[model samples]
Target: MTIQIKICGLSTPETIAASADAGASHIGFNFYPPSPRSVAPELASELAAITPRSLLKVGVFVNPDDTLLNEAVRHGALDAIQLHGKETPARVQEVKASFGLPVWKVLSVETDEDIAAADAYSSVADLILFDTKTPKGALPGGMGMGFDWSLLDAFDKSIPWGLAGGLNSENVADAIRATGAPLVDTSSGVESAPGVKDVDRIAAFCKAALDHD
Candidate 1:
């Protein structure tokens, strides 16, 4: 199967270009203010301007209100919406109806129950993203923490899905081998610091993900 890739939490034009050049299928812009990777709507627009149409621009938000989603969609020109917060299935439906964009609902997985929770959104969510659950009072995602890939073995695939959290060049191929993830996403894995993306790492990661058989 062909594997798709997403480089998340991108903030700069240089990294955005690098991601597209390296053959990424999707690029994410974080809109949550508390996270270090957060970007303003104007900055996201500037970065989106340089992005190629072949690549999808996904706006990442954490329990965002309509105001923030409105501004982000209008200014960022997002192609998809990734809900990385505690939004219910009803909220996911609301976001889809309001934005008229593909909605990817993130499920924080620690056990089979977490994986099973995706069923509630099978109807509304365009995509189901499995991520590692973070601690309370901490950032929701992009923390570079990975869970047991084996847990996904029990997943019923009731809907289309992708894998995220702690993926990088050195292990992305293995991740693909282990999980057969249709799409793989990463954020802090390609960063040199908290929110600083490393171009070379981005290239290597894309190469690894694409080269895997």
Candidate 2:
């Protein structure tokens, strides 16, 4: 089965190269400043420059406005925009229209009700991402928190979607099997520190996801 893997919150050249070399389908750059993985547009641009064109470059944002998206898209050379915040369906459409890029809205899930909320974004977003809901006063994502993957078994996945939050090499294949997620995203799972990605972990994650059948 060829599970698509996205290694998110990448900042350094070594990690970026590791993700690409490890056969990740997508690479993400964080634009949210509060997170340790966040990077400036210029720095993201430099990091993104080394990525091959075949690999999709994603820019992660938190309720971003036009200014932030524009700068990040231009400087980071993003291929897709991931809105990991409380963005309305209208906001998702607005971003798609404004940037003319594929927009991925994140659905923070804790209950079946949360998973069902994805329907509201069905027509607006090109893709939907299921991530663990962060605790109050905590950062939006990349917290290494996860919800019950079994909840997704009953979800009506009408739109293309992926899984995120707390996934690692050891458990990613199991997550995919439980949820049947075609795509899987990870950040802290492959990191040695808050913002530092471990190359070996990155490689292991890709191998594990791909080897899942």
Candidate 3:
């Protein structure tokens, strides 16, 4: 099966172009202030216009209320909402109902046990993002930390899941092979530094995912 790729944490228009030109299926713009990659809603809107219609624009939020979420969707023209914080299943349903777009639920997985939480969102989420769990008091993701890929060993079920947190050109193929993840996402992995996306690295990562084993 073909792998879907997403380049996340994009802040500027140049980075958004690089991701789109590199064949990314989705581009993620963060609204969380805690994230160094965060961009203002106005910038997000400007960058969103540059994206091709074929590419999906996703807005990342952290426990955002209706006003912020509405403003974000209004300005960014987000095709999807990625709730990376403590939004419950009911919240997910509300966001979906409100925005009328696909909603992605990001789950931090450390062990096989964490996979159980998927059930809570399976019905509501259009897609699930699996990322490495950070330490207490830490940000939700974009830490560049990798979990044991083997921990996903027992997760073989329906729903298209995307692997994230620590993936680059070198390891993405292996990550896909190991986890059977149909989609792979990267933020810090394809960057020269946190929030600084390397254009060449972005192209290389897209190539790596499409190349043979």
Candidate 4:
């Protein structure tokens, strides 16, 4: 099976080009100001401009209002919007309706109940991304913390879904095997430090996810 790969939290032109050159299907631009990987819409637009047309540009936001969303979409020319905060299904629908772009809803998974909650967004969200839940005061994702992969064994797969959290070149193949994830996402796992992406790691990660059966 061909697995799609998303390299998240990309800010610079070099890393964005690296992700696209390494065969990534999507590239994520973080808009959450508190996160280490955050970037303004103008910078994201510059980075997005160099991205190849084959790859989708995804804007990552957390509890964003219409103004931010409008600015990001208009400036960044995003192909999709990824909600990584406390947005409900209604909000997901509203974002989709307003932007006319595919919406990806991130679910912070720690238990079977978290996986089950995806049902609520099956109809509204274009895709459901399962990521690990961080600490109370920590960033929403890209902390390189993974949840129990077995928790997804019994997932109903009501809609298109992807796997995220703690994925690196060393463990992504195993993760794909464990959950049969159609798509795999990573940010910190491919970074040398918080928000610093490594080109070699980016290439290795995409290779690993693509080579997996």
Candidate 5:
């Protein structure tokens, strides 16, 4: 099966180019200001301008208001919206309706209950992204943490979903084989430092994910 790959938290032009050149199906830009990966809407637009239309340009937000969403969509040239916050199903549907764009809801997971929680978004979100749950007071994601992959063994596949958190070049193949995830996302895993993406790792990660049988 072909596994879709998303290289998220990209802020630099070189790394963005590397991600596209490496065959990433989606490119993500952070809109949350507190995160080191965050970029202004104008800069996001310039970075997105280099992306091929065939590839998805995702704007990652954390419980964003309509104003932020509007600016990001307009200036960032986003093709999809990734809600990586505590947005409810109603909010997801609202964003989809308001922006007329595909919405991806991120569900942080640690156990079976968290995995089961995804059912609530099946009808609301265009896609569901299962990421590792963060510790209290920590950032939402991109901390290089991973939950037990086995927790997803009995997950419902009615909704289109993707796996995130702690994925990298060395382990993405195993991750894909383990959960049979159709899509895989990465951020810190391809970074040289906090918010500093490494081009070689980006290429390697894409290679590993695509080369997996």
Candidate 6:
């Protein structure tokens, strides 16, 4: 029950309220416009202000330049920045320095070779998020697709990492048991539709994540 649960891609006030009510430890705001879940920085700021201090705020981006990241930090009270793109270790260092916020580096995992990049980010990332790789023509993360759980079997990683992609109320515990992830993330998994978060599903997902610990 010690694992952290992050409910990503929250847009509406109703869902934001449900996120804390459901006992989620963290809430994520997507900055990528292409994503159906994307919310404006001003709207994110409004949501963050109302969010309980007990819930941490995470800002998601995809290889964004410094300007957009700075704007999010200035407007939305983000406690962490989730780099869900092809950002290098050097960029990770730069983001941490420039924003003065804890940085999370997300690595799309498909095979054992993908785990090698973990070492490269180990020294800099506050946390490493392992998301299932997107299809040939899809967004990077939050594609509502999952990888084989056995792929993460016996993954003895040195850095702290989270498991994401296609995880929901039914499969989160099994995913955690297989990957030994210290954290669990959700987006489309808890949605009634694309970008629409379901409060009940959010609660169920959180319960499953906590039970795994």
| Number of the candidate with higher lDDT, 1 or 6 | 1
Please give each candidate's TM-score: 0.98, 0.98, 0.96, 0.98, 0.98, 0.95
Pairs clashing in candidate 1?
none
lDDT of 3 by residue, 27-121 (tens): 89899988989988998888888878867988999899999998889999998999999889999999999989999999898988887788889
Error of 5 at 25 (Å): 0.6
lDDT of 2 by residue, 17-82 (tens): 888788899999999999999999999889878888767999999999899999999999899999
Cα miss at 36, model 4 (Å)? 0.7
Model 1 gets an lDDT of: 0.94
Better of 5 and 6 by lDDT: 5
Whole-model Cα lDDT of every candidate shown, in order: 0.94, 0.92, 0.88, 0.94, 0.93, 0.87
Candidate 6, residue 13: the lDDT equals 77
Give the per-residue lDDT digits (tens) of candidate 1, residues 136-156: 888999999999999998887
* Residue 175 CA displacement from its true place in model 1, Å: 0.8
- Number of clashing pairs per prediction, in order: 0, 0, 0, 0, 0, 1
Worst 10 residues of 2 by lDDT: 150-159
For candidate 1, the TM-score is 0.98
Per-residue lDDT for 1-213 in model 4, tens only?
Answer: 889999999988888889889999999999999999999999987887788898899999999999999999998899999999999999999999999999999999999999999999999999999999998998999999999999997787647999999999999999999899999999999999999999999999999999887
| Model 3: per-residue Cα lDDT at residue 119 | 80
**Model 3, 36: alpha-carbon shift in Å?**
0.6
- After superposing candidate 3, which stretches have Cα over 4 Å from the reference? none
The better candidate by lDDT, 2 or 4, is 4
Candidate 4 lDDT trough over 10 residues, lowest sum: 151-160
lDDT of 5 by residue, 1-213 (tens): 988999999888898788889999998999999999999999998887887765689999999999999999998889999999999999999999999999999999998999988888999999999999999999999999999999998788767999998999999999999999999999999999989999999999999999988
